[model samples]
Target: MDARLMDATFSRNQPSDARRLYDDRAIRYDNSWHPRFARHMVELARIHSGERVLDLACGTGLVTYPAANAVGPTGSVVAVDISTGMLAQAKAKQADHKHENVQLLQHSVTDLQSLLQLQGETFDVITCVSALVLLERPYEAVKQWATFLTRGGRMIVDVTHPESQISLITFERVGRKLGRPVPFYRVPFQSPDDARRLLEDGAGLRNVVVHSVSQMDIEGRDDLQAYLSDIQHPRIEQAFTIGDADRLFDKHITDWAAQSLANDDIKQKARAVFREEWVKLADASGQIREVDEVFVAIGWKQ
Candidate 1:
C-alpha cells in the first residue's frame, strides 16, 4: 500500500490522538523503565497459578506478559488494549516468551459487549497499571471492572501521585494561570485517600489496599534545561509524558495552534511564562525538587 494511503487508513481506524500517540511511541516505551513498573505491578497483584487474569490497557504486554508468566500454564491471561500498535508490540513479545496461556485483544474499555464476554464468566484477577487516568470515565470503568471479578477475586490498579509528574503538573498550572488550559490527558488522584475511596465507594470493592511508594531528588541545572527542551518540542502533542521528562513535556503549541487554541505568537508568549513560573517554583524551596509518587491499590470483589 502507498504510504499516504496507509497513513489515511490508520487515521480512519484510530482517529484519536490519544490512541495514535501511544501507537507511535510503543517501541520507545517498551525500552523504557515502564517494563520494570509492569513487573512490579504484576508482583503486587499476586496473580496465582490456575487463576484467570485480565490485564487492562495492557500496553506492550508489560503487565500482560508478566501476569501471563505468573498465572503459568494452568492459568490464562487476557490482555486488552485500545492501540493495535501497542498490542502488536505485546504480540511480538508473546512470540519470544511464547506464553501459550496469554491472549491479546484490541478493544477499548468502554466497549463492554465486545470485550471479554461475561456470561457468568469472571476473572480471578484483573490488573490495570499506569493506564487508569487515561480512561474516558475512570470511576465508571472501575465499577464495571469490579463486575468482572469472581467472588473474592481481586483487582489491582495504579495511580500517579499529583506530584508524580511534576513537569506536566507544573506545565498545566502555568497553562491554567495563563488562561490557556490544554487538556493534557490525565486525571490525577490528589492523595492516597482519594485512591482508597475510588475503590471502596466508587467501585464498591472491599478490603481496599492502597500502597504508595515515593522518591525525591533535587533538580539540578541540567535537569531543568532538559525539561525546558521537552516543553518546547514542536510535536509535543504527539509525544508528551512524565518519565523521560527527565524531559517529557507537551506544551503542544502546534496542535493547539492548528485547532485555534493558540497561535504561534501566543505559544511563544506562553513558553516564556511557563519557564519563568517553573524557575520560581523550582527556586522557591531553594533547589528544584523532583518527585515521583505511585500508588498501587488492590480491592476484592467480595
Candidate 2:
C-alpha cells in the first residue's frame, strides 16, 4: 500500500452523496456498459440451486435477479445496498421478475454483520458488482463479510480495473490530437495485485482467488470520445455531480456526432508511444464495435 494513499475510511463515512449518485444513475447503469458483468458474478460465485445468496452492494438488482434465477424458487437472495433509491429500483426489478424468494435490504457493506445477524441466517454465497469503488474500507469490509460467511461459503466481488482508473490529468496528448485517451476508473486500488492483497490477504481470507476480465472497448467510436469528454466537463463531472449530468453527457454525444474528425489518428500515435510499456492495456482495450468488453475482476473468499 502506498503511504500516500487516502485512508480507507474516507469512502465509508461520507458515502451519502456517493450512494445517491448511484441511486440516480441506477436506471441507466446497465445500458451504459458494453459487457454483462452479471455473468462474471455468476461464474465467480458458482451459484448452486438451494443455496442462500447475498449480493452486497447490489445496485439496481443487476446481480440480484440473476442470482435469484440461479438459485431458483427453493433458494433465497438477500440483496444489500446503502442507497434507498437503488434498493427501490432493485425491489421494483424483483417485482417485475415475480421473484418471491428475493429480499432487498438497505444497508452498506460495512454493516453486513448487523444485517446478517438480524436475519438470523448466513449466506452460502456473497457477490457484488461494480460497487467496490464506492466502499470506504475495502479490507475491513471484506473481512467483515468473511467472518459472517458459512464455513465453505465464498464471496465474489466485481470492480473496475484500477489500472484503468487513473487521474484524468495524467494522460499524454499527441500534437493537435487528444493524447492517448485513458479509460475512466474508480478509486481504492490501482492494480489487481493491490486489490487481491487488500481484500484477501490483508482481510484474512483463507484462500483468495483473483481473475481479471475486460468490460468495454472505447476505440472505434467518435461517440465514445465525446462520452469521455462529457464526463470531464465542468458542469457534468460524470460520476460526481447530480443535476444536468445527463444533459452534459448528452452534449458529448451530440457534439461528437456533429464534429467531423478522425480519432484513430490520435489513438495510433499514442499507441506508438506506449505500445511496449502498455502491452496489456493495448490488448485489453479495443473498439467497442469490435470488442465486447474491457475487464472484470472476480475474487473468491476461501
Candidate 3:
C-alpha cells in the first residue's frame, strides 16, 4: 500500500500516524537491533509448547515466528499489526518458514478485544514488543489485552527506554537544533513504573512484574554503516524532503560538537571529525554500548 492510501484510510482519526510511518519502515524494521530484542522478549515470555500466543504489533513476525517455533505444531500464534506493509512482510516470512501455526492479521492493537471476541479465542501468552507506546490509547489497549488472556496466562510487553533509542535521540537533537518540538517521538510510558501502573491499575491485571534488559553487544561497529543506512534512510527521507538530509545532519553534528568544545576552531574540527566518522560517533558516545534498556512488564489474569 502507498502512503496516500494509508493516509486516506486513517485520515479521519489520525492522532498517531504510526501506520504510515511503520508501513514506510516495514522493509527495514528488523535491520536494526529489533530482531535481537524480539528473541529476548520471546525468551522472557517463556512461551511453552501447546500454548496459544498473541503477538500484538508483530512487525514482520520477529517475535511471532520465534514464539510459533517455541509453541510447536500443537500451538498457534495470532500475530496482528496495523500496517499492511508490515503484515505483508510477516506473511512472507511465515510462508518462507512454513510456519503453519502462525496467523497474520492486519488490525490495530486498540481493536484487539473485538477481534478476540469475534474469534472467541483466548491466549496463554500475549506479547507486544516496542509498539505499545505508539498506540493512541495504550492503557485501554492493555485493558483489552488482559481480557483475552486465559486464567493464569501471562501478558508480556517490552517498551524501549527513550534514552536508549538512537532514533529518539537523533530526533530530539535535531528538533532542538530546529527549535521545535517533535511530538512523534514523545511516548507516554517513560519508565518501568509507568508500565507497571498501566498494567496493574489500568488493565487490572495481577502480579505485574517489571524489569529491564539491554542488547548493546548484539551488533558492533562492523555492522554500523549498513544498519544506520537501512534504518535512517527512510526516516530522513520522510522527515526532510525539501533540503539535503546530509547537510542538515552535518549541521546537527556541528551543533552537537559546539557544546563540548570551548575553542571555536576546535569545534569546527570536531564537526569535521563527527561528519567523517559519524557512524563511529555512536560508539564513541557510549550510545552503541547502551543500545537498549527494554522495560519488560509481565502480568497475569486471575
Regions of model 2 farther than 4 Å from truth: 1-12, 116-119, 165-188, 217-302
Q: Write the per-residue lDDT of candidate 1 for residues 1-302, one digit (tens) a residue.
A: 22222223333222253366577677777665577667767777888888999888888988887787888899999888888788888888888885699878877765545554544668999888877765546788888888888999999887766555556655655555665533343445767777888799878999998775432322452222222212111111122222333232343433321122234545556566656655654443345445456667899997
User: How many angstroms is residue 155 displaced in model 3 relative to the true structure, after the best TM-score fit?
Assistant: 0.6
Write down the lDDT of every candidate, Cα atoms only: 0.65, 0.53, 0.65
Q: TM-score per candidate, in order?
A: 0.73, 0.62, 0.68
| Superposed model 3: Cα runs more than 4 Å off | 1-16, 116-118, 166-187, 219-291
Q: What is the lDDT of candidate 2?
A: 0.53
Candidate 3 steric clashes: 0
Model 1 steric clash pairs: 244-247, 245-248
Question: lDDT score of model 3?
Answer: 0.65
Colliding pairs, model 3: none
